[model samples]
Target: MARIAIIFLTFVCVFGGATFVKSIEEDFIRLPLTSLHSRSRRKADVVDPNAKKVNLWNDRNLQYGINITVGTPPQPFILHLDTGSADVWVPSVNGDCPYLCKAVNKYDSSKSSTYKEIPGKTFTLGYETGGLSGSVAEETISFAGLEIKNQVIGIGENQDTDLNSYPLDGIIGFPWSGATSQTDPKSTILGNLHKNGHIKKRFACLKLHQVNEQPGGELLLGGCDVEAEHWGRVYGNGYWEIPIDKVEAFGTDGNSLDSICGPGSSVPDCRATFDTGAAVIGGPSYLIDPIASKLGASKYDENINDYIVDCDDQTLGNLEFTFGKFKVVMTPGDYLSKDGNTCTLGFARLDDLSALLLGDPFLRKVTLLMNQEKDEAGLAKSNIDKPVARPT
Candidate 1:
């Protein structure tokens, strides 16, 4: 959720030290780039627009960061699946948004008989590149038959500018204070859903992909998607957490490289996290050669953290992990399909040390079902091999 400096500045004074929002009104106050809306203009109180109409819309995308297939035209969008931020926004008919962001045909609040302005819910988003300032107001929100009453949405200013390469309307975040703390950054989508009871005792599922022109890519909630559930019962780990089995190293000669594993050292452990937002398979560089050797796999560089492989090259193909007694395995086809003929793949040195973020490539192989209330995520083998769920 990239809010302009003003929004962040406002937060500094509020949650900065000891200020949780004093009032609902103070939550989204900001200085607009122009005098379009008076600073003194009050924000609107969100009302349940759907008290009248029921939308059949399904899987609306969360703007910014996270990538998913949202809304009509059904284009895949990257949104901020954050628990730290709130408000679901996407490009509108304003023709002012760019970077592959297309406006969604949302209901006009003006037409909603129940619409009411709480007065003063506008904000500005600041990103590393540019910024967007807008007003926050009440609006209709729904997807896959799941609807929330009086959802708070941000109405970004219709300005022209290129801020970041990844573009979208808004971020999906929830008011939460979970694993995030003063020492670490915070996010809260799960927390918010738990607050609203949208999710069961509290966890969600994510079945994301890296924007390919294929079917069966998405992030699920509460229950698992048909395709993602192809395997078996989903498993849960601490949200975004994984287990450490072992860690080793290798040299340029492709043999086992000698290294030390320690509690505080980077190269010494196999503990890692599973973040769907990331792009590539990242972890320690040292493990690359060693793991490949252990599997007897061949690698041909692709100039990036990727390569071409001969899937059936007699390498100790396929990798496996067991959480409890359940076995979740990554087959030869699961590594990274570089040579489709024999099922070959490749890897990249993620952090030079430490575990990889384990992004889309891996997520699609399994289902990450996080329990919001419990703050744990379950990992189950994907039924990807099933007849109905197989990719088209």
Candidate 2:
């Protein structure tokens, strides 16, 4: 009952109350995301620094993969490249999956000739624990090397039992085109490769990789890696939004000691969704009950409804979230996590105070681009600067 690290992503559900902040029709380019504190030995660069990359693997940071191939003479699988999903599924050898789709490889479509079968449609999905109910075809997927013909997949058939525990045999929603539940709202595979032009720039860039390191994150499609320093630029309505502008509780010189939500309260200007499937940082419950009672964290003990915190007083103060004039800080080792000492407190609660998903413990500490050509969204700090190879 008390665990706090959810990632689900299919339709999104979590409920509680209070956290609103929506109304930015578009127009934000502010920078200075705290300059990520500065650190440069120089040499890092990106602005297409060769673009085309698709390497990700990490499953211990909880999830991240990319192997894909799909249908018509393709096959292969792996997936989970979800930027919080938008469509592109798996687990179909005619459905009936169980052992978490058994190490995932399925998707026969009778061996594919480019599958195709969006007839009576079915497609369910949804996961915070379960639900798949598939069948909704149209294949020819591919990845990184690029090649996305028909797209719109799904397949499953019936699932639950926690999809067998996931070893990865599904999920590939790079989020965009009508944003998932797929029945073909433009087929999203990068919006059918930017509507047939095959991408001149529609944007996509994510890096995430830390806990054990070797996954060497990478997902740049279309273009953007432009790193060199603590990047910035925010604005959304297209998904990747940010403008929390306040969350509060900080001391030890960090300042702010009050206001747990934002602006004039009552859930006003709060916004927070970055949703890489949402690993945790939900919101509402009057903004996580006063930042979990000034970080002493308790209540929610329905045995394990979770709120523990004390992994050594979780870094001793500082939680900030500002986002419009920058700020972004999160010390306490960034929200707290520790299994043996039993820490837990990445913040959770939700009913939707307008928006607040910010998942993956605040996106594995930054480095995201998502600029659907001017719709804007870029954040910095996670740049180890390695991508620049593709050019066969």
Best by TM-score: 1
Candidate 2 lowest-lDDT run of ten: 19-28
As a TM-score, model 2 comes out at 0.36
What is candidate 2's lDDT per residue for 72-188, written digit by digit as tens?
Answer: 798877766666566666777766644434544677788788888988997766554556677787778766556787777777768764543245566777654444344555545
Range of the 10 consecutive residues with the lowest summed lDDT in candidate 1: 19-28
Q: Write the per-residue lDDT of candidate 1 for residues 284-376, one digit (tens) a residue.
A: 556555555555555745443454555435434444443444445554445554322533343555543355445445665665555444344
Q: Which stretches of candidate 1 lie over 4 Å from their true place?
A: 1-89, 92-140, 149-187, 197-200, 206-239, 247-268, 286-304, 308-316, 322-324, 338-348, 352-354, 385-392
Q: What C-alpha lDDT does candidate 1 achieve relative to the native structure?
A: 0.39
lDDT score at residue 159, model 1, on the 0-100 scale: 40
Candidate 2: which stretches are off by over 4 Å? 1-38, 49-69, 73-89, 97-108, 114-140, 143-145, 148-158, 162-169, 173-204, 207-219, 222-225, 228-275, 281-293, 301-327, 330-361, 369-392
User: How displaced is residue 228 in candidate 2, in Å?
Assistant: 4.3
